[model samples]
Target: MTWRPAGVMGVAPSLVVALADHLQKLGAVERVRDPADRRRQILTLTEHGRELLGVCAELARSADAEFAADLTEAESAVLTALLDRLTGR
Candidate 1:
């Protein structure tokens, strides 16, 4: 998806801005002015960013699987629900 600032939800705007700045600094993303609207900017991920994202996703999946290894299906569901609630998701 094209990254528009408006598409972000449930995150504080300041935190979003800070993350964008950090990513740009790391060469992971670039803020490009929209051609049709020069006043507007769009955040686009660089190749490096895509690679990093893939790695992070894999790590998360591995960690989640390990974390749930000892839990039964019902226990896993309950744990997921409790975590979601704790995170206000």
Candidate 2:
């Protein structure tokens, strides 16, 4: 997730930290200390975050379907492949 925002989305690491702090405040995620490494923290999604993720997934699927409505099945497949490649998925 950090790699996605920093590398794929081209967001600054500082901004990502700020956003992470904000999410923590909002109870979307919780930070847990790593057992093996006291210096590191692990961020895990909360119940709220899981629900939000499900909603986002549905919305993205809807958007993708709408965006490809006019294209043929083959064209949509090509577009999806291109998008997956571009997103480094």
Q: Whose TM-score is greatest here? A: 2
Root-mean-square deviation of each candidate, in angstroms? 3.7, 3.4
**Candidate 1, residue 39: how far the Cα is off, in Å:** 3.3
lDDT of 2: 0.83
Error of 2 at 60 (Å): 0.9
Model 1 lDDT per residue over 3-88, tens place: 55634566777778898899999888989988988976788999999998999999999999999999999999999999999878
lDDT of each: 0.87, 0.83
Residues 1-89 of candidate 2 have per-residue lDDT tens digits of 22255555588867877988998997889989889778666789999989888889999999988988999989988998998998885
Candidate 1, overall lDDT? 0.87
Which regions in candidate 2 have their CA more than 4 angstroms from the true location?
Answer: 1-10, 35-38
Worst 10 residues of 1 by lDDT: 1-10
Kindly give the number of clashing pairs for every candidate: 0, 0
